[model samples]
Target chain A: MSTILIIEQVLNGLQFGVMLFLMAAGLTLIFGVMGLINLAHGSLYMVGAFAAAAVAGATGSFFLGLVAALAAAALAGAVIEMVVIRRLYAAPHLDQVLATFALILIFSEGTRWVFGSFPLFLDIPVGLAGPVTLPGGIEYPLYRLALIGIGLAVGLGLWALIERTRIGIQIRAGENDREMIAALGVDISKLYTLIFALGAALAGLAGALVGAIQSVQVGMGEPVLILAFVVIVIGGIGSIRGAFIGALLVGLTDTLGGVFLPELFKLFMETGAAQKSGSAIASMAIYILMGLVLVWRPTGLFGARG
Target chain B: MKRFLMAAAATALGASSAAADIKVGMITTLSGGGAGLGIDVRDGFMLAISQSGRDDIEVVIEDDQRKPDIAVQLSDKMIQSERVDVMTGIIWSNLAMAVVPAAVNQNVFYLSPNAGPSPLAGKGCHQNYFNVAWQNDNLHEAAGAHANGAGYSNTFILAPNYPAGTDALTGYKRFYEGELAGEVYTKLGQTDYAAELAQIRASGADSVFFFLPGGMGISFLKQYANSGIDLPVVGPAFSFDQGILQAVGDAALGVVNTSQWNKDIDNPTNAAFVESFQAEFGRLPSLYASQGFDTANLLISALEAADPSDADAFREALRAADFDSTRGDFAFGPNHHPVQTIYAREVIKEGDVFTNKIIGTALENHSDAYAADCKM
Candidate 1:
């Protein structure tokens, strides 16, 4: 209700939006370039966290763990692409979904088997663990602020990668005409592997960064993955720019909705009744936003028409 | 003709042996999000069975995959094909609600190791169902009492939007004789809590009580620490259990929770249990494991008190409160739930171990507040 509270909610929303963008950029890019609807993308995110945790625990250096996360995820992605995903490109979406879903099962079970059914701790490194004061006497986490920075930098880096590099051109070409790109003597398989690995690494980076603020456990990436999907879907599947905007929109909507809806409901109902109704409606707000977006622009805000 | 007669004789022997074997089926969230709690229950139950040396106890363990449909299917198979005499280990309430009714339909005793849904604690209670854990409402009630006793007025409550969360807030409100500043029902397994935390800070509640367990707990605690919301955070045992200890670590320090068991509880039985659990698991045992250990011990006591050769006899013995629990003196209530002490504890750093150390015992011989509401 207060201007200060509204500002704080918006900042909170932006931070969440940034995190979702980190997840969605890789996902949408992978989908756009590889033509793979990977259900196992979340598993790669898990891999990143596990890798980060293992390395960080071993090294006691969060920085090293982050690097390890990127390498591990990329390696895992490449290997999976070479062995499993390469075969699935020609397969139907259902088959791809099933195979990737199996990968999620295998990854989750395997992580549990290795880590032993318990969540691993990844800390916000010593200095970043504290809070930073914002405008209007509000305090925000230093690590989350760092994440917002990292997410923006990564987004910019991703945009540059796709728009400013030879590989980026090849990827865009592959997206536009895979057969044409292959006919032009480009090693499409290698390109696909590179894109997949890059996407995986990005996912892993997000996982490692987020894991510091959460638990690094099996299936940890799932809920975020769903949100990332929602982001990409709303942004237009394939558009990194759209992912950023869409993620922020969703983050703000979800965050502000949860807070304000209940207060709004309180105007007409008892406190408890207002909260129950408000929370229920707020929880659905993002999906509603997504639905409305779809109703208006079926392909998404930035999606290419077939 | 001789082969046929030999086959007939083996079939008769097999039938008799099958009748003698006590089939126990377990359905838990052995995979996905609920795996941490489910695995502890599974391990404790297995350890107890191993300790019992009861080779006749055949436990067919199945992962519910945290899906109700899968749980129903697995329970159905165990009931119809395996014909399990005693069934146990359902972690989630929905899974239990889905599977327990089916077990009750078959007249099989469903020993719930966790998740004592309120409905089962009341009107929907079946004679065949026994809950080893506290009624899902008991722990949160302790939290409410703790908050009230600690002078936390106008507290904001946050929980995942689910049956357990609903029950948890209800439990808190039952004991919390204070103005509720606000209550936010978040998405179950929400990774991000900054939005909610910001709102909580803005709402200016004196304290925030939450019921996020497992990974959600870790995220909430971490985010809360990050948000620098200096309010005293409180919740039930699962919010700061061993499963999330290392995950939350020092961030969880100063956070208060209420539970039925703490590893540091001074008791001979708990001492022995803790030592062995640490030795075996190489980590501290969670309350879920404690419930599982109690379930195992309770089952063993029932077996000892009953005619194991007769399934119906064993069920009656189990219902008759046959166990000396690890939680000192405890017994199953008429609705087949534990009426036990609930302790309020703070997450503390005990050298290398980051776990809850009991600071207060809120309810001594406290039955669930919801029990009176239940006619059954």
Candidate 2:
């Protein structure tokens, strides 16, 4: 591959990774603070995508639709946290998995009930549509480049909030010791809801943005959700910093693996067989990476004991 | 009111007429990723059966959920319990391969509404099985023909890595005289194609052919349109069909696709079916729907000639092909798959809706390449 091609692939990987980070950040945060594994995180992402598509279709305003996505997802998350999640805090992991799995079904069917079986279209805003030529005569989509920038900005913003703010301290404290914080003046329940809503809103934002490029339909979020789980696990669960790095790593591995594996295989095998085997291995590249990472550090790359 | 009339007819025919009942058990994907296509097929099949007003035709429908194992189980249940004489309405080829072989072994007349996998067209062909749709390879071959006719020299071809995907590319290559710029098989259900699109843009190919069905096609087309790569794209009708066309929107406009039928096919039966389908379903019928409707009609026509209980006579009647098809001229080949015309369709805006209109014929009186291999 040429330097320009490699650079483009890297950009594609980064764009994918950044989107994964948006998902992983919330999931890790929820896991870290609430100590509850929420499998319905992907459902929140779906809610956002549907909300964006529906609102944008109605108003023809993409910004307002994005706002609606965030609001809808956050409100839904807050409601779900208060009702079902609060009851499940002390429940076992199996119960959490089952309940959240049930939520996934409810959300999928509920969305299908509202939108029917057809996929909804979400157009890229006219201004952001099309590609921009980079240096070295390389062309890249403007929206994707913009997503990378947005992801970085969000990452930085999240770091600032977590490290430099009062709420960040309380969140960190809560993560460190929920019982100790509860003994102090902190209203642990309200904080948990806020944190859950925050994580949910981030997922919604990712969904709304990605929906513009992909088909907005039921079960869209599940694949991304699985990838995000991979991201968090690899980055070290409950670490925002780990999520950031892990998302990029998985993203790069997936994108570059998909592009390069077949070419790599072609060197040793016949062309058609090479392409087939290369793609087969490439699909499993991320999972293989995760396995290696876990073998090396069971807690993840940045994970530490509580 | 319709229920009352059906009830009245049922009583007149006698409730004890189970022996004469031409029970058709349809197992199709009804609740998963490509559920929309299966739903359309089911509706179209039901429309034909309901229109025939045959009280003796009792249909039992089961949801396959797009699972091959589930399809096998449902087929077993339908054959053993429902005792369906004529069975139809399977959409996926994998599901058909699983269910057709086992079900047909027990003397069930398997009339395929869709999913004409290649093995069945050749050495794996069964006397009890008949494909009402065009063989799976026909549409892609027609696409290759269209690409050749359009004077494309080097084409980048892509499909998912599965039996159908392999068949699609092979079929394209059989007819396509152009130099292959690249051939790639992506993971099935892969929604993102930016990496693939980047390769296509760089490959310097003059044309592109892909065969991703349902949501995969939607995502690919949307991503490709924005990639700013202006290469002319051609493919089979899986992506261009009515169910997902609205989701694709203007991104799919001006693209060419190949199919055996279109709503605009110049036939009276085609015209009548299109109008009634829209009237009943409040949506345009897809190629899948057309296949389902044709399959149902074919079954009905065979029933007119012989009872399905008499397997040999019914099979002969089906081979006679007495039914009028939505596509003007259709008949079963020696292998019992369709030997019919495949048309080239161009996606165009019909007022507000995005759908295809037939631009020209790709292949006339086409039979599959595998017919000679079939011993049957």
Candidate 3:
């Protein structure tokens, strides 16, 4: 590959990594603070995408649709937290998993009932519709570039929220010692709900942003959810910084692997066999990375707890 | 002893009366990501059955959830308990492979509305199996011919890494007379194409050929449109079908795709089917829907000649292939797979709706490559 091509692939990897970080950040925060295995988080992502598509179709404004996505997902997250998740905190992980798994089914069927089985249309904003010539004469999609900037900004914003704000301290403290925070006059339940909603909104934002490029349809979140879980595990559970780094690592590994693995194999094997074996291994590269990371550091790169 | 005699008599009477009724069990994906294709096939099949006004044709539909194991289980249930005389309404090739051979072996007529896997068309072909749809590779082969017609050389081709995916690339290369710039196999059910698109951009190919179906196609097309590579794209009709074209929006516009049937196929049955389907379902009929309609019609035509219980006579009737297909001049090859014309369609916008208009004939009177291998 040429230097220009490698640069372009790197940019693509960064874009994908940033997007994964959005989903992973929310999941890690929710798991870290609540200690509940929420399988329905992906459903919330789907909710955001569907809501954005609907509002955007109705209003013809991408910005308004994004706002709708955040509101709808947050509202859905808050309501779910109060009605279902509130009761699950004291429950075992298996019970939490089962309940949230049911939520995924309910949310999926409910969305299908409303939107029908066909995927919805959601395009990038007209201003970001085409590509831009970057430095070194590389032409890249402006929307993807914007996605990277937005993801990084969100990452910074989330970091500030967790580090600089009072709520951030309570969240961190709650992650450390929930009983102590509860005894210190903090309404842990309310904080849990707020954290869930905040995490949900981030997932929703990712959904809305990615939905513009990808098809906005039911079951869209499950794949991303799996990747996000991998991200948090690699970053260390409940660590936003870890999640960010892990997301980037997973993203870069996946993208670069898909492009280069086949070429690497081509050098040593027949063309057809190389493509087949290369792609077969590339699809598993992320899981291999995860396994290696766990072997090296079981808690993850940034995971504080065992 | 008296009660047992009476129950036996009642059972005999019920069996005699039920002999006239033809029970068809349809196991299709009605939920999950691939639901759209199955729904269209079901709707079209149901529409034809309803229009026939045959109350004796009892149709039992079940959702397979797009799982092969579930499909196998459903087929077993239909064959054993439901005692369905005819089985149909499978959408995916893998699911068809799981269900068709076994169902046909059980003496149940398996009329395929969609998904004609190559195995069933070749040495594994059964007398009771009939594929109303083109073989899985037919459209891809047509796409290859269309690419040649469009004068695209050094094409970059890609497909998901699976059995059917391998078949797609193999089919394309079988007919395409051009040098390939690159060949990549993407992960199945992959949503992102950023890496692949980057490769495409740098490949220096004059055109791109891909065979990703369903939402995978939508993602690829949208990402490709935005990537600004602007290379001409060609593919089978699965991606550009009526059910998916709306979601794909303007990104799909002006793209050439190949299919065996279109709404504008210039046949009386097709025109009426398209109109009534829109009237019934409030949307244009997809190619899957058309296949479903034709499948039902073929079954009805066979039923007119002989009862399904009479396997030999019914088989002969089906072999006659006398039916008004949505695609005109419909007939099965020796292997019971479709031998029909494949047309190249260009995606176009008519007002706000997205649909296909027939551009030209990609392959005339095309039959599958596997037909020669069929001993049956």
Candidate 4:
């Protein structure tokens, strides 16, 4: 491939990787600190998208809609954690799964009831609607580039929050020993709430950002949540750094595999057979990568052993 | 105590002497992913029946949840126990295929409001099964012919990896003479299209035709717009409709869709339907709703024309296609599928609603190409 096309593909990969990271970060955080598996994380994402769409429609301001998305997601996260999620922290994983699954059903149905079964569209703001030429002369969507930038900023901000802040220290302490931290007079319950809300905001932000590019509707978040789970598992569960790396790897692998696998197969097979086989294998590539990674590093590349 | 006994005796005598109501069992996807379509069918049929001033037909609705097995089981219950003379209402192709065969086997006349899958339209055409909707492939074929006429030489086809998807692509390719740049089949219920978008961007095709319905359509249109690819796009009506318009918004503004009905069809009947539908539902009626309304009218007309009590007579009357459909003068082909005009529609925003306006008709006096292939 030409250097220009190669550069463009790499950029495309980065964009995808960054988006995955946004989804993975909150998922990993919630799984790590809360010791609670939330299947409804995607529901929160859907909530954010709906909130953004609603607000954007009301005010005709995409920026305000985005802000509302983050706020709404965080608020929802807090409320859910306080009311329903609090009861599940000490519950069995099966119970957690069932309850969260129920939450998903309720959220989806409630959203449908309110929104009336049709998808709410979030328009790309006029400022970012046009295409921009990249360094390699690739005409990329400005909104997509903004998403990459947003994802990167969120990732870095999350890193700083976890590494440098006092809340970060408490979170780390809680992750290491929840009971001991409680004994040491830290508000462990409040910490959990804060972390959960923060994680939810990240998910919400991801949803809202993606919502501008996609339709905002019920059950829209579930597929992305599945992929995010896959991302975090590959990245090493409960590790922010791992999630970042894993998301990028997954994003790049998925994007490049989809495009190049068919071309690679064409070298040895007939065109039609090559295309079919290639596409099939490309979809399976990341799962295979995750499997191979598990074989090599059972705790993942950066996972903490219990 | 004597007075209460006398009143109870009189009420009991009145209840037992009342004529048995004609019960119709309507199985549809009333919940989960396919709920919207089923709801539209239910509401449209209810509206039509209500407007018709017919209280004789008592409809019992059941949710099949888009499962073929559930649909078949529901059909069995409706036919065997309830002994519903007529069975109707299915939105999904697989569900319709499953349930209709069972209904036919039971010697019950099946009136399909939507989902006229091709196999049933062809060799499997049972006299017992009648569809008020056009054959599934017919509209896509119109799109393909239109795309070919418009001089799209190198086209890319995308669809979910499923029966309906395969049927749609086959229909399009049957009429389209373009050199296919590529045909991509993504996983069913896939939400992310970034990878596919990248591939499409790289494929260098002049036009892209896809057959993603409902939620899939919304997701695909949104991602396609985000990818910054400027190729002309076309699909059947399901790709761009009232059910999905808000989800797609202005993204579908330039996309060309082919359909048997558009909201902007200038006819007195359609205009009246639209006005009343919007008044009641607070939204424009989707073509699915229109088909549902038409289905109701068709059944009523056929019932009026023949011996309503005879299932055989009702089936024959329905196949005769004697109803005045809002889509103008259209008759059912021998296979019990509508032989009607296919119009090319463009998605344009009017006020807050996204609606498909008829731009042109692809075929005038067009019968489905597959009709001759059906020896039934």
- Find the candidate with the highest TM-score and give its number: 3
Docking class of 1: medium
Show the lowest summed lDDT stretch of 10 residues, model 3 chain A.
A36-45
- Evaluated on CA atoms against the true complex, candidate 2 attains a DockQ of 0.71
lDDT minimum window of 10 residues, candidate 1 chain B = B367-376
Pairs clashing in candidate 2? none
Error of 1 at B18 (Å): 6.0
The residue-by-residue lDDT of candidate 4 on B154-261, one tens digit each, is 998887767787788888988898899888777677666766666677778999999888878887887787667889999999868788787787778878999999
Model 4 chain A: which ten-residue window has the lowest total lDDT? A1-10
Q: List the residue pairs that clash in candidate 4.
A: none
Across A181-262, the per-residue lDDT of candidate 3 in tens digits comes to 9999999889999999998998999999999999898899999999999999999999999999999999999999999999
The fraction of reference interface contacts (C-alpha pairs within 8 A across chains A and B) present in each candidate is: 0.82, 0.57, 0.74, 0.36
Error of 1 at A63 (Å): 1.0
Q: Considering only N, C-alpha and C atoms within 3 Å, which residue pairs clash in candidate 3?
A: none
Give lDDT tens digits, candidate 1, residues A1-306.
Answer: 778678777887888888888888888988888778988889999999999999998999999999999999999999999999999999999999999999998999999888877789888789797788887776778888888899889888988988999988998898889999999999999998988899899899989998988878898887888888999999998888999999999989988898889889999998777888898999899999999999999999999843
Q: Of the candidates numbered 2 and 4, which has the greater lDDT value?
A: 2
lDDT of 1 at A161: 87
Model 3 spans > 4 angstroms off = B1-20
Top candidate on lDDT is 3
Considering lDDT, which of the candidate structures 1 and 3 is the better prediction for this target? Answer: 3
For model 1, how does the per-residue alpha-carbon lDDT over B1-376 read when each residue is reduced to its tens digit? 9999999999988976775557778888887767889989988778777867786677789899989999999988988988777789899888888889878877788888888899888888877788888898898999999988899988999888888989999999999999987788887777888878777887879999999978889888888887777898889988788887887877889888898988877878788888888888777889899889888888888878775457678777887776656688777776777878889898888889888888889988888655565554
Alpha carbon lDDT at B28, candidate 2: 88
What is the RMSD of candidate 1? 2.8
Model 1's alpha-carbon lDDT is: 0.86
Chain A TM per prediction: 0.97, 0.99, 0.99, 0.97
**Each model's C-alpha lDDT?**
0.86, 0.91, 0.93, 0.83
What TM-score does the A-chain of candidate 4 achieve?
0.97
